[model samples]
Target: MKRLLIACETIRNEVELALKNRAVEIETIWMANTLHDSPDRLRDALQAEINKSEAAYDEILFAYGNCGNGLLGLKSEKAILVIPKYGDCIEILLSETDNLERIRTTTYFLTQGWLNGEKTLDIEYEYNLKKYGERRAKMIMNIMFKHYKNLMLIDTGAFNVEAALPRVKDIGELIGLDVVISQGSISPLEKLVSGQWDEKFCVIPPGHPTDYDDFLGISLSKP
Candidate 1:
């Protein structure tokens, strides 16, 4: 049996789902910095965790973002990173005027297909396509389409789509893709090698708070 470390940008719901249905023993690191804004604090915090359990896992896998702490000297034997592209496009398609329930169903189907690595033949299949249409949906689809075009599906590593948006949107206001594209880059292969890869131990303490959620607990399992 191969031991693997799965480092995530936020919660490990997707990975946990995968683990429940797979055979591999997955050790997850549920990083609290979903937005990747507080590099200094996140770096300091993860380094401390690495120090305590530096001999339990064989490789590291980043479910989302770049795992900024990788640059902080964490050790790992091997690492895999999963980046999910695409937003809630179905919501954009369903005209609030359209039969709200049916539109919701269509939107849910499309988004779920995208999430589960399935392809949608026509991007505008059940969408209104006009009146409610805008370039935002197209932009999102183009990026997501290009990202998954030729990639092989890896283990399901999850991220907080809603949470990471603000900082990314802020970065977008800054320098755009040339800089933000690397937001989820992986690094520091050796420092993340703390082998204590238990899915139960993925959460870290001293989390952050946002207007988005009340008392954001950083632990893997919600408090």
Candidate 2:
């Protein structure tokens, strides 16, 4: 059966890596990660894409999380829709159940995709700098990042480390946060792409409309 993987460009590396490793014969549609800036717009865009595939695919998988609740109400009529049942990609990166909460608390996670995605804090920093001047921009940035104590880079082994490491480190420096590099596993993405929809995923069968409640539950996979 033909499948379509719809996802933000942010996880392109990890998703592609998983697909390549699994050798899944699914076609991918890359969407701009900037859509998150406006949740309603993102929902509309994703729904439009999903509607387009109602006749083309037997199964359609979303390579995304709840995001800022942007993907709250998406549904499909002809194909089963599947997605990770988590708040954001941070959970997908740190897909381990045992240490999930331990590692994610007060942490602002980073990935190669996040670094390149639009409408991010870093992007806003530059915008604030130009629009509000150094003083006001610094205050705004501080307000934005005050809750985050660590800037973690999820080393998913999906891309070249030599290049990505420095970028995360530099971002940490610019943001004045402690930089941490952790070994992340693509096992989650690998499992998702290969149809191992365990407790960690939300499986919305065909003909069912998705709801916000679909994002709730114990979705951590067992070790």
Candidate 3:
């Protein structure tokens, strides 16, 4: 059966890395990375994509998380919708199940997709500099990032990790946050694309509308 993978640009690198060297037939459609900044925009954009590709594939897989209640009202009548139930792309980047609980409290996660996405930590800082003077930008970001003390980068094995260090170091120094690097896996995205719809996934059938409950529940079983 043919399947379409509708993914957030924020985790595009991980999804691409997951399909590497594997005989997977699913086609990918990368949604704009900036959509996550506004969930309503993300929902409108996703529904539009679903409408555009519904006839071409048997199923559509969404490689996204709850994303700040963005996926709450999205639904499709043309094809079955498959998506992960995590909170956001951060959870998808930090895809290791065991490591999530351990690191959730202390760190903010980043990935190649995130590094390149809109409103990325460094990009926001730069935007602040461009809009406001250097002194004002630093002060603005200091208040914006006051809660976190750690910047954790999850290496999903797709891009050059070392090449990203200078940017990471800059963020750490700017926010007084310690930089930590960790290993990541493609298993989550791989499974979602491969039809291995385990507990982590929500399989919504055609003609049914998805609401906030889909992402909030413990188990989103197929009917």
Candidate 4:
């Protein structure tokens, strides 16, 4: 079946890795990672893409989680919509890990794809430092990261985790959080691409808009 995969660029590396060697006839559209900052905008952007491409594909896959309800109203008039059953990309990547609930509550996760995004933590820090001055920037950062005790750098095997550590460590120091490394899986993405839409995914039929109820009962915790 012809498929269109619309995904956040924040997980571009993982998505690409998941599609490698796959026999499926799929096309991909990568949306800006920064769009995640505004759920409303993300919703609008995704809807626009779906409207434009729905008629041409047998199925449309979203490499995203609920994303603060960004996917709430998205629907395809002519194609099935498949999405991960998680709160966000972080949850999707760490889906196979044990203690996921505890890890999400106390840790802020990062990946190379995330670090390379336009609105990465370091970029935000620099912007704040420039606009609000160093003192205020530090204060703002501290407040923003107060809930996180550790900055987890997840190695999804799509990029060099070793090379990213220095930058991750610097960001952790800037936010007064400890830096830790963990392995992340792209199995969820792989499953999506390979049509393994099991319990970990939400499969919506044509003309059926995704609802908040679709995500209910999924164990998700936002960091």
Candidate 5:
């Protein structure tokens, strides 16, 4: 089957492993540059690649669970596949077992702490990010990992990296269900501007969890 691998962060290793295991033929590799707003541009570029591919693949899959990057605009005549983001997949895997309430509680607590501004690494210039700043970012990640570890226990009955990789590995497995894949990529700012990806792809980046995003203070206006 004809395949496309859209490279994105977090899932690079997983994608390679899946391709190796499934023996899927990768017809083209589209790498989007997400340096600045490049993630947004990358989504557009991927869409353009899809149109240009001339329907060569019977199906397409988004390799990363983080397909929220501006992809809602893409409507394919062929089968389109998506792997839910890490958070969603974790929620799903947790659902398969018991303790849904506990998991929700843990996620809630961690997310809440993040919104309140917890910091692990005391980096300077953290306030420049326009979001919760670096302090809050690390806090959110730590909280996520804490809850993520607990969630993994539902699968492995313990908390460890072994549990975590499997969670990511499962995402790759989901992508394998389809023939074509859409994923995210990293790029230098220069490559992003020259590539013109936004003409086609759309980036649908998810917001910080409702309770965790301090940046919710930013004013949003409908154009």
Candidate 6:
């Protein structure tokens, strides 16, 4: 079946890595990372892409998670919509692990894709520093990241983790948080692109809007 993968640019490296050696040939469309800042806008952008591409492909795969309910209302009029059953890319990267909930509460996840994004934590820090100077910038950053105790970098094996360490360290220090490195697996994305849509995926038939219950299997209030 012809398939098109629409994904967040923040996870481009992982998605590309997953595509390697796959038997399936799925076309890709990378969405802007900045849209992640607003779920409503993200939803609109993804729906627009789906509307434009649904007729050309038999299946449309979303390499994204619920992402603050960004995928809540997405639907395809022609192609089936497939999405990973995840809350965010961080969960997808660490899908093999058991302590995801604990990690989510105290850790700020990082990856090469996130670091390379247009509006990364470091980029935000620099912008603040330029506008408010060092002292105030540090204060602002501290307040923003007060809930996070560690900056956990996922080594997805798709990029050179060692090459990203210095920047991760700098960001950790800037935020007064410890730096941590964790192994990550691309198997979930691999399964996604290879059409292994098992229990780990939310497969929405054509004409069905993606529901919040599809991801969690529990009815939660829509955002």
Candidate 4 lDDT over 137-166, as tens digits, reads 999999998999999999998899999999
lDDT of 6: 0.89
Clashing pairs in 3: none
Q: Clashes in model 6: which pairs?
A: none
TM-score of each: 0.30, 0.88, 0.89, 0.93, 0.38, 0.95
Greater-lDDT candidate between 2 and 4: 4
Worst 10 residues of 4 by lDDT: 214-223
On residues 26-116, what C-alpha lDDT tens digit does candidate 2 reach at each position? 7889889878778789889999999998789888888887777777778888888888887777777777645767656667787888877
Overall lDDT per candidate, in order of appearance: 0.32, 0.80, 0.78, 0.89, 0.35, 0.89
Stretches of candidate 2 above 4 Å error?
A: 97-99, 218-223
Give the Cα error of residue 165 in candidate 5, in Å: 12
Q: What is the TM-score of candidate 6?
A: 0.95
- Put down candidate 6 lDDT per residue, 1-223, tens digits, no spaces: 8889998999988888889847656778999999999999999999999999999999999999788888898999899999988888888899888878877789998999999988888899999999999999999998999999999999999899999999999999989999999999988899999988899899999999987678875224564
lDDT of 5 by residue, 1-223 (tens): 3444454432333344445444545543535324113445755676676666536764444443223334334445553433233332233223244555564543322111111223311221243334676566555545534533222222212223343444334432322211111121222111222222332222223221112121122222212
Q: What is the lDDT of residue 141 in candidate 6?
A: 94
Better of 2 and 4 by TM-score: 4
Better of 4 and 6 by TM-score: 6
Residue 66 lDDT in candidate 1: 24
Candidate 1 residue-wise lDDT, 1-223, digit = tens: 2344534433244445445444445565565533345555655555555444445533334343223323223333222212221111122122123454443332222122233221232334224235346465455445544423121111122345445445434432322221121112111211123232332112222221111122122112221
Local lDDT at 25 for model 3 = 64
Residue pairs of candidate 2 with colliding backbone atoms = 200-219
